[model samples]
Target: MGAVRKRSSADRPPSSDRGRRIRRSERVPDESGGTGMRRPIWTALAGFLLLAGCAGGEAASDGQGRPDYGEIKSMVKDILQTEDGKKAIQETIKNDAVKQELLFNQEEIKRAVVQALTSEQGKKTLRTTLEEPKWAATVAKAMQKENERLLRALMKDPEYQAMLLDVMKGPDFEKMLLDLMKSPPYRKQMQQAIQDAFESPLMQEKLYAMIEKAVESALKPGQKEKGGEKEKGGEKSEEGGEGGGK
Candidate 1:
């Protein structure tokens, strides 16, 4: 008889299996002999609450068959704290519709900002905040790095460099510079620098060396005169000896 051919696993039909796998969205059989359909968490939660009179019984509620605001808030908070709920919220926020809904017009934003800044309470708050030394220092410290980076970028820009040159060459800027140099604070700072130099050990050593060099220079001419006179005396003695021999 001819050999019977066996069908390979890969050649077999997909539906030939006896067992069926359950899909995530498919209905699951419950122990109560009923099928449990997959539903959204919020929908299931709302359904459960409605079935249980919102919050257990009438006594647990606001004397009504509905949950109180506090209970509802706590329930919502608990749901929001869950990973699934957070992921859902994040997905909802990332939706195009949500972005369009949240976005405000530029004119509206500008008007709101102007109103806020111009308001009496806002001005007072700003003035008080600025008047605080600690707050001012903290804000300056935070902005220092950003300001330096911005300045560095501006310095590299040709337009910014031209603008800076224009400002620097202006009479107002020159006056400001001169006024700063002539200020009492500037004089005091100069004095402090001089005092520091005088107090420095290196400066003191340099000064001492300078004084020794000056003294050596002052005494050098006297030594040179004596040496010249001794040379002349030796020359005269040599001449006298030559004449005596003659």
Candidate 2:
């Protein structure tokens, strides 16, 4: 050949490329579960947690109708590690679908959480229920499992599944869990709750020891119940009676 044919850059093999390249079609989903561009996993997880908390109870309906997002935002800020992460949480709180799912009117949920955190009753509840390390761990784990179940359900619907996968690819969904561990406000909150409990006349060291012993006794491996199925039957009777009353 008298003249060498010139090869275009597009014709170059990927293996010879000097810089890394990613597929445009492989970008992560937005907070609303819409896919287009890739985003951080922290962003995705923040979105997921916020959505899950809002969706999991009767509050979703009540919240969607009159959201106190400022409260929700404050709680998230009170609990997350970084400013970037807090911003992501705030943005998630502002999402419309989240609002509708939780029945929170815009930012009302945020305000409610903040209000709860600052209030005596809210602080007491957190101390009584969420302050225990073991219980906090349990609630966190259960909430995560529930969120995954919800995400799996979302994926079963053709459109939503594709969106969720995109979000997963952006960051380790587990990072959110890690961030939660690093939060100072939560640690303080838990410590305060434990202190409150310890101060109670009804919660002396011996009593606390006894309660722990009882719980351990009831949790024996392979046991259905400490008293077996009869206790379970009694619980059902109470539940049934309550339902009938309602």
Candidate 3:
């Protein structure tokens, strides 16, 4: 008879050295995980696999004394679906190391998001969503405060100031202003503003004072105009050259 062939790494069951190591770790602490959580989970898995593989190692063997991968996967899935599995997952997530790992992945998530938004499919989806008036309105309302804050911050930026000045100084802006000024609505608004100004008591007093000053100024100009009598009825003053009062 041929010598009994020694088992290779590929022939060994998952419950071999792995199962024993898992069992050993359960008695000690797992500093990396903040608790011995990983050990217990692994120990449970190893014990299950050991049961299926240890008896002559033939019952759950894929072909020759090795546990089947498909069976292992199905078993893991069934285990994960249990309530205890969910609780274990939640506890594991509470670990500081896990939180740091999640935070560290944020930059990658951001890049993925940007790439998605820039893609054609994402653009089409965005356009469809925005076309819904209710959605558009809700988004606008939600973003209003943020938009205002961003604008306020931008207003303080020197680059933004320069860009705004450049735009206002452009020929297109000048044309736009001229067109706005020429519009009937703009003329109507201007007339309405003038009427409102006249109706205001302060504006009325200011206008009245301006008119009185203008009258006095006109009279002074007239008095200094000619050295001889200019009015129909003239009285020449010997003290100084002056125009006759109208």
Which 10-residue window of candidate 2 scores lowest in summed lDDT?
Answer: 16-25
Better of 1 and 2 by TM-score: 1
User: What's the CA error at residue 6 for candidate 1, in Å?
Assistant: 98
Q: What is the TM-score of candidate 1?
A: 0.32
TM-score per model over all chains: 0.32, 0.17, 0.41
1-246 per-residue lDDT for model 1 (tens digits): 122334465465566252344353245666555444444566889888898884566556555656478988999999999999999999999999887776856678788888988999989988999899999999999999999999999999999999999999999999999999899999899899999999999999999999999999999999999999999999999999999999
Ranking by lDDT: 3, 1, 2
Candidate 2: segments with Cα more than 4 A from true spot: 1-106, 131-135, 142-246
Question: Would you list the rank order by TM-score, best first?
Answer: 3, 1, 2
- Top candidate (TM-score): 3
Candidate 3 per-residue C-alpha lDDT over 1-246 given as tens digits, one digit per residue, 9 for 90 to 100: 133344464566677688888887786676667466776898999999888668646544546556578998999999899999999899999999999999999999999989988999999989999999999999999999999999999999999999999999999999999999999999999999999999999999999999999999989877866633554234435323444332
Per residue, candidate 2 scores C-alpha lDDT tens digits across 1-246 of: 323334554566676343333443335444566643344666899899988886776676887889899998997777786788788888997998876777845478788889999999988998898878999998888799888988788868988877767766666766775677679987788899999988988789778899999998877753765567888889999999999999
Best by lDDT: 3
